[model samples]
Target: MFAADAASRALGIRLLASGPGSATAAVVVTETMLNGQGSTHGGHVFLLADTAFAVACNAAFSPTVAAAASITFLAPTGLGDELVAEAVERVRQGRSGICDVTVRCGDRVVAEFRGNSREVHPRAQRPE
Candidate 1:
């Protein structure tokens, strides 16, 4: 069981108090995450969302891996504008699960992400 705070800390994400997923974790956009235009880079946003997904999935299953993932950039995020990413479990089947994630800043959604993950036994915990 991964507490929300621990999950956020593990992923280097911060929890925001407002937004679509306000009560959830959001990645703080920094200068190092900017692109040539000084806007948040798409890869950086994706990584943030991906990290959230990793924590969400693995928190329950111990070990999980992303099987498929995609993100659509809707708007640009500037430096210092906290980029919030949220992951909600959509469906689960056996050892596989699907999550719908969204990244936003204030009222503007920066990106939408969907991730498919597979739960696997940890290498050290593998059965003989």
Candidate 2:
């Protein structure tokens, strides 16, 4: 899944590691990623977290997509900051699951993301 993620790749997102129900990704803040105040834009942070969430949810080979997601920005980051996002599956029941992603620059937490995922492929659905 991460291998085919064009959007994430375009923003210089690199998949660091992944395993069953978990993933880690990183991106460097670039000049183009900054906002008016010279801080990294929230969208970029969200994308980093979203990418990690996508990888974690899709680790099982079943196509999954985010049904809903939200993020909270705790700190500001700027150009040259290497942001790392770690995603972990919090819950999975049937075809629905929840994942949490934490974006950090070094030891400082920059953002927290929560994603609600739903398996889109029929093969992932439980038989009645």
lDDT of 2: 0.96
Taken over the whole model, the C-alpha lDDT of each candidate is 0.73, 0.96
- What is the TM-score (0 to 1) of candidate 1? 0.78
Model 1: runs farther than 4 Å from truth?
1-12, 15-23, 124-128
| Candidate 1 whole-model C-alpha lDDT, 0 to 1 | 0.73
Each prediction's TM-score versus the true structure: 0.78, 0.94
lDDT of 1 at 94: 90
- For 1-128, candidate 2 gives per-residue lDDT tens digits of 88898999999999999998999999999999999999999999999999999999999847899999999999999999999999999999988999999999999999999999998865555779
Scored against the true structure, residue 113 in model 2 reaches a CA lDDT of: 100
Candidate 2, residue 67: Cα displacement in angstroms equals 0.4
- TM-score winner: 2
